[model samples]
Target: MPKWRIGYRTLKTAIGAALSIFIAQLLQLDFYVSAGIITVLCISVTKKESVRASWERILACLVGLIYGSIVYELIGYHPISIALLFLLFIPTAVAIGAKRGVVTSVVIMLHLYTIEGVNVEVLINEILLIIIGVGVALIMNMYMPSNEKDLTWKQVRLEDCFRSIWKEFASYLRFGDNSWDGKEIADAAAFIEEGKEMALKNVDNHFLRNDDYFYHYFKMREKQFAVIKSILPFISTLDRTLIQGEKMASFMEELSQAVSPGNTSAYFLVRLNELRNELQQMELPQTREEFEVRSSLFYILHELEEYLLTKKKFKPDPKRTKTVSAKRLNRDHEQRDTK
Candidate 1:
């Protein structure tokens, strides 16, 4: 039974449509069913999107009503008029920022043309129906269930991917073999991008001025991942016998364990600095080939520093584990109040 249940947002949207349909019917609107259809069309995953959709729909509705009436009057409700209406009026609506409302505009044009004439009474009826449909959708979406946990879940998965990738890199450094498929790198990248998008959407779902902590977290990781990618080719060429290769391998193995939101990058930062200083203090390369390998080792240490500092930007609160988004929002609100 739970599996068959509709999502909370979808259920709310359906109820919104039902209420609009009832109101339109009670008022005896000519195309009463259109109200319900509009509600369905306007329901979006976030409140900001719902508002944009409503604006586009209403704008397109107006554009279609005005030009559609003119076309209907000139060409007498024929197929040629319909074709002309779409080609001309649709582009005009897009130019006016109603691209998402093209279908809704077409429906409105068809409705007007089917009625065969436009009068003050008919135009007012359409306007009232639009109000009911868009207004009800707004009411339904003005609030949302707290979704900080969703962001937290996404963050954990993303970190897990990062950890896995690092472990694979460490394995390659230790064995000097490409036994592990590189698919997890792409998967982790895709997850990071997806997590960022979801976090931004979560931010828009609320009216409160909350910071999107997860979005920033993913962005930081993405920057660090870029450095990691740059170092991979160097890792591929080096053997365990090369300078710092074994040490770096050991570093990655331990680093992978701290890849969670609660862990700070300070420990890793200190360790990488120590490694960099140690590498600099070593005697100059005895051979030309050793010089290149030594240079690559130094470069890898610099990249590791960049990667670690990126993770240090945020101070993750353990309390954020529960209702993170809401808490951040409230914290911001209080800060504003204090100021």
Candidate 2:
């Protein structure tokens, strides 16, 4: 957002504008400045977008040129004619989603009006100027300097934050200490949200889906992080020794390490089940206070299960197959064939 933060796109746009003007002048076009203006307007952040802008402007140019010629030659080049052309064409352009090209379109129409007529020669020249301007912008946008590295770095930083948070959760569970700051949880959420925005704004907004959705991964992580914070109350209210807090701490530590995208959370799910079994095997609390504490611990385990389940559900181990059932079905088929 800073004025001095001229990115690669800005440099491309400036260069394209200059090139467009030079070409128009070289070609001896009457309105060379118009070409530069068109080029500046056509240059966009993405190559796809620049091409689309150029196409829309080219179409809009034709609309304005055709209409301007009719108005000037048939009616006359007067204030009333210009106003009438705009009244008719602006709504037409807007209806066709070419409203973005309205400025460049008006410029083309004004050029026609300036000449007081649009004969065959003038039309050809206008078309050439439009092409030179729009084409230059398209070429400028064709190969953007790759920001993939920056996006990957951001992803890595976000994952690192998640790992640190998980590690903290483990430590908190292991030792009932107020050593950690709650601001870290807030910081993690902020990082995820911001990282998500950047990732979404990156090149692959259309094709990226399901597992490739960088934003989805972080959003899911944030949801689990909220649940992780929910466990803090259980940690605070209950006596740490009475609950199987050490087991949870160990599970969280392992979960922290397996936080990367590639790591399938099968091991974490297995550990969670083991912890559930362990908790279930223990004697039920007899005292009311003890029961409440145990219930809180149960709630923590339940939330932890949900967290692990979310990870497993979303990112299952691709290598793991449903081969056991398939094998049984195959054997049955073989037996039937023999029969």
Choose the strongest candidate by lDDT. 1
Clashes of each: 0, 0
Among all windows of 10 consecutive residues in model 2, the one with the lowest summed lDDT is 316-325
Error of 2 at 294 (Å): 4.6
lDDT of 2 at 277: 91
Residue lDDT tens for model 2, 66-164: 888887887898999999999989998888888888999998999888888678889988898899889898888775665444545555555666677
User: Which residues of candidate 2, in runs, are more than 4 Å off?
Assistant: 1-6, 71-75, 204-238, 282-299, 313-339
Show pairs that collide, candidate 1. Answer: none
Cα misplacement distance, residue 287 of candidate 2 (Å): 6.0
- TM-score versus the correct structure, for each prediction: 0.82, 0.78
TM-score of 2: 0.78
- RMSD per model, one decimal: 7.5, 11.5
Reference-based TM-score, model 1: 0.82
Off by over 4 Å in 1: 1-5, 143-145, 167-187, 314-318, 321-339
